[model samples]
Target: MKENGIYGLIAEFEEPDQVLAAARQARAAGYRRVEAYTPYLVEDLAEELGMHNTGVPLICLLCGITGGLGGYGMEYFAAAIHYPINVGGRPLHSWPAFIPITFELTVLFAALGTVIGMLILNGLPRPHHPVFETPFFEQRNQSHFYLCIEAKDPLFDRTITQEFLLKQKPAHVWEVLA
Candidate 1:
């Protein structure tokens, strides 16, 4: 059993289907802290890995709404209340004039929120990950599929997890070092 902080077991498979199957089995066996890496997106993989309920979309929506409201409010305050500028005999609170800015701000905030939300959700900007300690992890971006069960899982133990991974018939099962 590895005694490192990142003491986790990784199972390497030749095909994405095998990884998906192993993930389903892991989820069924009550493993909550499991993640799979694949070269390309796999349909139903998120559900199999129990990662379906992400909140990024909701966050993006809220941010877009906030941005649209903020832009509209700023325009209202500047043109109508604070510094009323009636140009070309137009009304101070012209809705048509504010539409373009409001739309632009909504798109800008939605895009920004999506990017930041994804980064935050995925725990990004982590230049170095404990999984990098494994030699075979580099194959993740190529042909192999990997499923890692983190030590943070309540049912995690290096020896038992390694045994379980081996039973899944992976080509290689290694312990990640922190």
Candidate 2:
């Protein structure tokens, strides 16, 4: 099934249910590496892939903490240590004055972290992928759903995987090439 050098085996499905069932079947069959493509969102597909716990929130939290500390420290150093100008008999180390800027910085950094983390996790800016070589690729942009079992997977075998995909009752099955 080496069509122009095989990257993997891809199956095309007509409905989200078919793709979801196909992904579940692949997972149940001990296939650890599987990918699904669809024209729109299908939440169950991601659940089947066990992609529920992304670390974006943790990244955002760390960034927010760092930003808050940095902002507060900078203000503290500037007013309390460097300048030390007491205004209206108020203490030089006034934490209340730092709260607004510290909060702002925390939100800004957290937002930035969320964006950067998402792009990094999703492998963004990727202009090309081997799946694009499949003839059914065009259909993916329209209405078709695709599930691919990568060749690099530990359980992959050309004949066996092809048979497995065929058993999923897809519209078409192809040997994806790099």
Candidate 3:
């Protein structure tokens, strides 16, 4: 354990199975604030962490609806109320003509919502994090798998958490400092 402030205790594993097992054990032991890092996606990892649901779909839906309405509203006001011009003898509020712009705006807003919502939800734009303080953490980009139990967890105790992590038989364990 670190003499100073601690962010968490991270266990390094050589295989995805080890990380998965450690995460499962941590959860079973009533540790809620846990996270894992790996070079690639591990099947069932998110389920083990209980992190399935996300709000991105709902955000995209609402944004797409708003964009469609705004697009139609803009065209309606411009062609019918603001500048009334009978082009090609069509009706002032031509539904077919509005379809193209509305569709485009719906797609654009949905894409934007996906990007913005992901950034916001994932807490992006963070150039650095305390987890980087762990030794050999940079190796996560290669073959290593990591499981971290945060100090902020309600059930966290330095000695007990470290002992629990040790029972998982990790290759290395380190105290992540803030």
lDDT of 3 by residue, 1-178 (tens): 3234889889999999999999999999999999998889999997898788778899999999989999999999999999999888999999897999999999999899889998999999899999888887785647899999998888888999999999999998899987
The TM-score of candidate 3 is 0.92
Candidate order, lDDT descending: 3, 2, 1
Model 3 clash pairs? none
| Tens-digit per-residue lDDT, 1-178, candidate 1 | 2255675888999998899999999998889889888888988998998877788899899999999999999999999999997699999999997999999999999999989999999999899888888775774547888899999888888778888889899999887876
Off by over 4 Å in 2: 1-4
Taking every candidate in turn, the Cα RMSD to the unseen true structure, in Å, is: 1.8, 2.3, 2.1
Question: Which residue ranges in model 1 land beyond 4 Å of their true spot?
Answer: 1-6
Q: Alpha-carbon error at 62 in model 1, in Å?
A: 0.7
Better of 1 and 3 by lDDT: 3
**Which of the numbered candidates is closest to the native, going by highest lDDT?**
3
In candidate 3, which residue ranges exceed 4 Å CA deviation?
1-4
Model 2 TM-score is 0.90
- Cα deviation at 166, candidate 1, in Å, is 1.2
Cα displacement (Å) at residue 16, model 1: 0.7
lDDT of 2 by residue, 126-175 (tens): 99988899895865657899999988888888889999999999999988
**lDDT for 48 (candidate 3):** 93
